[model samples]
Target chain A: MYLAKIHITHKASILDPQGEAIKNALHRLDYQDVSNITAGKYFETTLTSDSKEQAEATTRSICESLLANQNMETFLFTVEKVED
Target chain B: MYLAKIHITHKASILDPQGEAIKNALHRLDYQDVSNITAGKYFETTLTSDSKEQAEATTRSICESLLANQNMETFLFTVEKVED
Candidate 1:
């Protein structure tokens, strides 16, 4: 088995309103040192695969097909071997 | 400056309906090897701080105050120095 850890985040050019709102909220709560915030999604998935390469390919396909919006977001993931 | 990468995830005992939904969707898309999925939130935050320890403390406080719900979610974070 393999465990894939994925992070899907907005592209640098995209404006993240949710992140902006959170930054504003933190400021209101007195975390004045905060400068910038980018909020995104994280996922941990377990896959039964024969090899590391296959596991990675499956993870990338999954991210591209369903987890991320290619127009506005990009995803990065790492697959690691695990005992199952 | 320091960059803090934070992940907020549901506790093991908590039920995650969104994750279940995504798992089912992947199955429908022919990803039969996929077994378990857990979804969470990720944040990349920049803070102006003099030291790594201070940045970490600030990040933890921010997470506790607004980023995470203590009742059901747990958070993990890492702070690193960054060029400003």
Candidate 2:
């Protein structure tokens, strides 16, 4: 088995309301020393496939189809085999 | 400087619509071998604090105040010093 972890985030040039909200809250909570609290989405999937190539392909397909909104967001992923 | 990485996810007993949608999409994309695509939120904060304790305390305060909805979601975080 393999584990595929994916992260999706807004494009650098785009405004991220969720991220901004978090940053504001951090400041209000006396965390003034912290800044730029960017928020994103993370996804984890367990692929029951036998081959790494198969798992990668499957993960890629999923990312393109629904895991991300390619128009406004960018996605990056890592695939690793599950240790017994 | 330090980096605070926070992840927030729905409680196990709660229904995660985003996760379910991603799981279904994976199957539709011919990734039938993949299952349980759970989704969550990830936040990264760069702290300019000089002390680890200060950073930790600030991060905890932010998490409780707004980083997560304590009633429906659980949050876990890791704080690491950044290498120059």
Candidate 3:
């Protein structure tokens, strides 16, 4: 089995209003040292793949087709072997 | 400068409907090998702190007070120094 740890985030050029809101809330709560914040989606996925390369390919395909919006978001993931 | 990479996930016992929906979608898309999936929130936060310990403490506090619900969710984070 393989485990894919994925993170999908907004492109750098896009405005992340949710992240901005969180930063603002932190400031109000006296966490003034927080300089910048960006929010994203995290996924822990387990799949049955024959090899690490196959796992990575499957993960990438899934992200591109479903998990991430190609126009506004970017995704990165690491695929690791796991004992069943 | 310090960077805090945080992940907030639902508790193990919680029913994650969103994750279930994603898994179903993937199955329909012919990713039958996908066995399990969990979704969470990811944050990349930058803060000005003198030490790694301080940064970790601040990040923990932020997760406890704002990012995670103690009853239904849990969080983990790593604090590392970064080039300014």
Best by lDDT: 1
Question: Ten residues in a row with the worst lDDT in model 2 chain A?
Answer: A22-31
Candidate 3's residue-wise lDDT over B1-84, tens digit each? 999999999999999999999999999999987899999999999999888998999999999999999999999999999999
lDDT of predicted model 3 = 0.95
Model 3, span A44-65: residue lDDT tens:
9999988899889989999999
Q: What TM-scores do the predictions have?
A: 0.99, 0.85, 0.97
**TM-score of B chain for each model?**
0.97, 0.90, 0.96
How high is the lDDT of residue B68 in model 3? 93
Candidate 2 lDDT tens digits, B46-66: 888888888887788788788
Which residue segments of model 1 deviate by more than 4 Å?
none
Instruction: Write down the C-alpha DockQ for each prediction.
Output: 0.94, 0.75, 0.91
- Lowest-scoring 10 consecutive residues by lDDT in candidate 1 chain B? B48-57
Residue A15 CA displacement from its true place in model 2, Å = 2.4
Instruction: Give the chain A TM-score for each candidate.
Output: 0.98, 0.91, 0.96
lDDT of 1 by residue, B3-79 (tens): 99999999999999999999999999999888999999999999998889899999999999999999999999999
Name the better of 1 and 2 by TM-score: 1
Instruction: After the best TM-score superposition of candidate 2, give how far the Cα of residue A47 lies from its true spot, in angstroms.
Output: 1.4
Interface RMSD of each: 0.5, 1.3, 0.7
Grade the docking of candidate 1. high
Error of 1 at A8 (Å): 0.4
The DockQ assigned to candidate 1 is 0.94
lDDT of 1 by residue, A1-84 (tens): 999999999999999999999999999998988999999999999999888998899999999999999999999999999999
